[model samples]
Target: MTEEIKIQAQILTNEVCQFTVDRPILPKRSAFFSQKEDAKGSPLPEALFAIDNVVAVLISGSVVKVTKTNDEQWMPIAKQIGAAIRKQIQSGQPLVAEEDVRRSASEIDLRKKVETILNNEINPLIAQHGGVVSLIDVRGADLYLQLGGGCQGCGMADVTLRQGIEASIRRALPEVEEVLDVTDHAAGTNPFYSPTKK
Candidate 1:
């Protein structure tokens, strides 16, 4: 008797649900698809995005982390997500396109993408707190960021860094396992990568 692939689902947050399977959905590097447009060549993401309310999909190893709009209940949608993943696995196609397989985490490319994420997604949200984030460097798959302005030495700096900034980065760039904050806030500090200047 062939053991069927079983998916275990856990609701992580209001907008996020994490699913796991016994087999590797993505044996290689993890991938994050921001929207349906980004899922062009990735069949797994394409299928996952087809389910309504799935705003983002992250496939890391045997885990699938999906983010949906808060309007819908996860009970029904979780079933759909599991079904979609099962279909994809049963189909036996590459989760991502051959050309899209992640490379050796290029420093130049990682820097550019991380910078774009900060400029577009992260900084704007944190700016409400009068804070700014800049990339210090990329050492392998690790990121060093300098928190400035209000975030330099705020009481909630750690919360913002780990929960907000790091979560966003790790979600987008699965290869980034560590996001190190190297800001010394005692005095006003210089930014490593200034969004204004770039």
Candidate 2:
């Protein structure tokens, strides 16, 4: 029988400097970022750092990217973030609470708003990247989105989602709890390839 190799991963940065994993690592529910404080009542594990500093967490076969606050540096923290993720994977831990799969009233609204945004704003812009955003579903106030085409593996995908797409959605619809990208960031032709600036 042939042996199945465990997938390996690396970290990279976008134009906005947000860190993203070069490969996908599936995680479980109890597995969570060590940085989020408001997670006390939630089943998601507390991120090792704080929300302002966390970039994302691999939970339940997906990456839960965090929104950073204005006071932290992404470069100095990338190693720590990577180490934490490595340690968690080595330990085989869960990434979130099962209950987190349920949708909240606000989250439902956010999903609708996201659908509208995708149909109206995001899709048109990302068409340039040969990418598209589709609403998978919503759980609680969190909105799950799938990134397609060039956007799927583009190195700048995360930055575009967070800074441009997400910001636009939130501005148009403030009820959104959190925007989650469910795209397998590790797949697609030339995935995670960011264009260099002149």
Candidate 3:
């Protein structure tokens, strides 16, 4: 007998709602889709794109993080998303097409590419603020990054990560599924920008 498709919703932020499935949905690498066209191989995200207000989809492990373009209530949209994902899983269709299987490059090569972009594009820009970003690890399609100096405890770090660093990585290397910041702000010795300051 097939396992029941059970889904639970957790709100990540005002705009992002995460739906967790009882079963695994995707591979270890997270697939981040900003637009419908970018969701080529994944049937789950394609179905999610059909929903009216979904602006982005991130399929990581058993969780599907959906970002809404509008500020609608999460309850209604979560229900719709839960049902859509359940339907797709029950149908037994391939979540990702065989032709679209993500090609894995050597970890060394991937790390080098990410570092080069950071050194050339991202690091130089953030350096002006006394911040430096280091590539911590490259596992599968995930890129773990460490932020130091000014970026460690800055109020704008999250914004910078989402808008600046992530966009740059995605634009440069489409295969990189996720760019995660692993900085421990509590240990930050010197923070260039403080949130409490007026």
Question: Scored by Cα lDDT, where does model 3 land?
Answer: 0.81
Q: Please count the clashing residue pairs in each candidate, in the order shown.
A: 0, 23, 0
**TM-score, prediction 2:** 0.43
Model 1 lDDT per residue over 1-198, tens place: 445889999999999899988898777566666568868878988999999999987777899989999899999999999989888888877877754446322654687799999999999988887889988666568888999987876767888899989988888899886888888865645323223423
**Per-residue lDDT of 84-181 in model 3, one digit per residue for the tens?**
99989998998755433353234546877988999999999999999999876676679888899989988888888889999989998998887888
Global Cα lDDT for candidate 1: 0.81
Residues 1-198 of candidate 2 have per-residue lDDT tens digits of: 433323223334331232343334433222333235434444333543442355334243445343344466555555555555555545545434444433233444455567887998889988876888877656556778888888887878888889988898788877677889889977666544556675
User: Each model's RMSD to truth, in Å?
Assistant: 10.9, 12.8, 10.2
Off by over 4 Å in 3: 98-198
Question: What is model 3's C-alpha RMSD?
Answer: 10.2
Better of 1 and 3 by TM-score: 1
State which candidate, 2 or 3, has the greater lDDT: 3
- All candidates' lDDT scores? 0.81, 0.57, 0.81
Give the Cα error of residue 70 in candidate 1, in Å.
Answer: 1.4
Q: Cα lDDT for residue 128, model 3?
A: 95
Flag regions of model 2 displaced more than 4 Å: 1-108, 190-198
